[model samples]
Target: MDLMDLSHQNRINTQLSKQKVGKTIYTDCIRAENIKQIVPAITQCIECYPRFHRAENPDICIMVTGIPNVGKSSLINALRRMHLRKGKASRVGGEPGITRSVLSKIQVSENPLIYLLDTPGVLSPRIENVETGMKLALCGTILDHLVGEDIIADYLLYTLNNYPQHRYVQHYELEGPCDNIETLLKEIAKKLRKTQKVTAITGTGKFSEYPDGFLFH
Candidate 1:
């Protein structure tokens, strides 16, 4: 199963179509919490698989795997809540490497007797290009520090401007869309009040500003 943010719906669909994989189901496991679409789809898959039909119980065991910090554990928990009315069977976090090892099967359903095994996220041994690596870093699949925050921030700004996504203009109250990162950062710092006073070498206090992180909302 793959977990994705709905905001990138068009890009996700286009990429998936190029892979030639059949019968893929998309679900917004975190934001929309739409497990209602998943249960029936999973049932249909199991019904079509001949090996499951030969078994007397026909219990289903699904393995959840994806890139780091892509919400495999969150999906398991959501499914359990939807089907069994139970609390979390797995731990969740905002950063990657939260689930380091394979977890034992956790029951999510009773009637067909469904269980899901949560596994650590994996990445390809080789990345095709620099742009792909940066994209992964932006998605939180890779550690931000490894790629350097400045580069990620700059690439993000470039992408936003390339797409001409102007929400940032209104959010930060900028005069208009900007191509310069330094100018945009200053505006953001001022808007968020993230400036601090520090003593200079000449024994004079000077204010330094830093941009604070924010969600698009």
Candidate 2:
């Protein structure tokens, strides 16, 4: 399952009703680690067959494309495992833009003479909207510092509240559904023991704040 579902299924339906989004033609979410489904998924997107039956080309080149951190590299590696019984040929990581160059094409199968061409993840220079950009940042498709963790975390809380996704409330051991993001983050920072000290001026006079330096508190 996705750490965060970017598909926005229900939101997409709403967009479709407003004629803001096109009708979905095809979609499938497969585990990158699942070798069983990888080959079929690859074949569905490209033609793979016995090399002898195919034309003059020495190998069939299959190009993989998607936004940053969308598992393009892992899919190539998984395909290799499923058909070629081999290990990873491309580097993969949680950060965005992990594959930022032309990676060496990997041979996923000998019988079919298939090769996977991995390319750098690219995004349009212009983002359509603020919300879309925030969603991208929340999904780690953009670097955290670029968008700011505080802003991203707040957006996540806003979205969760709008959707009334309370799993996070209980997960963070909050008393209940809280509307304030700062309060929520305070609780999280407390749970994680990530408090830092700060100085503040008060009626009592200038003093160190929270003693424990409770950030977001």
Q: Cα RMSD for candidate 2?
A: 5.7
lDDT of 2 by residue, 172-201 (tens): 787888777787877888887777767788
TM-score per model over all chains: 0.79, 0.73
lDDT of 1: 0.80
Question: Evaluated with TM-score, which candidate comes out highest?
Answer: 1
In model 2, the Cα lDDT at residue 211 comes to 57
Q: Among all windows of ten consecutive residues in candidate 1, which has the lowest summed lDDT?
A: 208-217
Pull out the clashing pairs in model 1.
none
Look at candidate 2 and tell me the lDDT of residue 128: 100
| Model 1, TM vs. native | 0.79
